[model samples]
Target: MADTAFEAQGESVEEVFRGATQALLESMANPVTVSGGWERAIERTDVDPSTLLFDWLSEVVYWKDAAGVVFREAPLTLTREGDVWLLRAGLIGAPVDQQTQELHADVKGVTKHRYELKQTGGSWKVIVVLDV
Candidate 1:
């Protein structure tokens, strides 16, 4: 793949995933933590690598909606098993009460618009547009 796909110049998929997780961590108001859910999920099924990005991100939104927790980090793993596309990841963060926080309308999914991880310099950055 072209190096231009990464946000942190010259980064690989692993690096991009790491950077995106870190960026998500920094954007949160509180510290979010991840459990072993990611590993367990990945081990359980088959999935497409191309679809993993959106599924992984969407899962984050699902957690926020279900638990009201904006994760400080999203540790995602994409692997293929058979013909299925599996997305396994864990989220870390504190839960925000529905009454106290001004919650925006929940995001339905991620958009394909500018959805890329690029490498700039010696690091990676992710540019993602959410589709609500």
Candidate 2:
């Protein structure tokens, strides 16, 4: 197996995270085929932006595995409180139906290998490598 990586750039941190999640989700399953029925609320915190993205993505992966569901969208808010990065997300999706939905490569986990999160020129940029 080889490392699979994706990059997302946005004007805001929240947008970048959303884009990153979209990339990850699309790599695992077809978002369009998964009904936006199931829902999960997640809250995570970290001291650093990079770590926050890593942990939050890992948590998303955990939910996907634990619930045996595919997600279509994650409406989230990423904010800072006293130097801590807080991510609160409402993840929406449905149980994967093999007969109706298409599943792609399975994601093993989010890895720190070549993980990056940075802001340059008023835009946020991220590069995440997934263990697939």
Candidate 3:
């Protein structure tokens, strides 16, 4: 098993979330090889950023585990409705083919251990740990 840890920071919540998705993609395989042959729509709402991040990443892991899909690009939009934050995302990737794409580590799921999401200064920063 392998453990992958990464930190992503951005000026906005959307950028930070996209960075996290990129980190997840990199952990699984080369992003360049992952073409968009399939699509998944992810919608999540949470009261806080940390929980939203965890749910968002867990959704990605769900696709990987259930459908063998690894996302290379995630174009998302975030909105705030009262006290809740809503995320609507379009995920792009193809089904993992062992012979065509080089496999790195199989990420089982996102771990709550060492997971952090915070706003420092004017930027949003997130740290994620993935269990492989």
Candidate 4:
């Protein structure tokens, strides 16, 4: 059985992702949010998973910047293999760039920005981001 503790923590993470996704989506309709999200991401350093999150979020922001499309909430999956955890999520918006874009980091490549989530033992984990 899945641990109740993970369920609680996962809910919090989901909320954050949902809010962030919504913020980006809202930006498509309202220019202020788009600019704000972009400005916030720009002000920070491109640090591994941190930057990965920004880039993932930025992709949505970029759409608003380029075209103006809002993405719906996507189901997230978490998986693990040995010591590596894999996170999978379907891209849920009509994005301008269907083509995979190389992240400005050690991330090998974007899996269509899709992810898979999984758990093992008593710990829940996923490939939140990659370092290629």
- Model 3 TM-score is 0.92
Every model: Cα RMSD to truth: 7.2, 1.3, 1.6, 14.3
Best by TM-score: 2
* Cα-based TM-score, every candidate: 0.54, 0.93, 0.92, 0.35
Candidate 2 lDDT:
0.87
- Candidate 4: misplaced stretches above 4 Å? 1-14, 30-48, 65-68, 78-87, 93-132
Ranking, TM-score, top scorer first: 2, 3, 1, 4
Backbone clashes counted, model 3: 0
Deviation in Å, model 2, residue 118 alpha carbon: 1.0
Candidate 2 TM-score over all chains jointly: 0.93
Q: Write the per-residue lDDT of candidate 3 for residues 22-83, one digit (tens) a residue.
A: 88888888877777899988898999978898898888878887888776688889888999
Ten residues in a row with the worst lDDT in model 3?
Answer: 97-106
lDDT of 4 by residue, 42-69 (tens): 2222223323444555454444445433
Error of 2 at 110 (Å): 0.6
lDDT of 1 at 68: 55
Give one digit per residue, the lDDT tens place, for model 2 in 70-122: 88888889998999989999889888788888888778999878778999999
Off by over 4 Å in 3: none
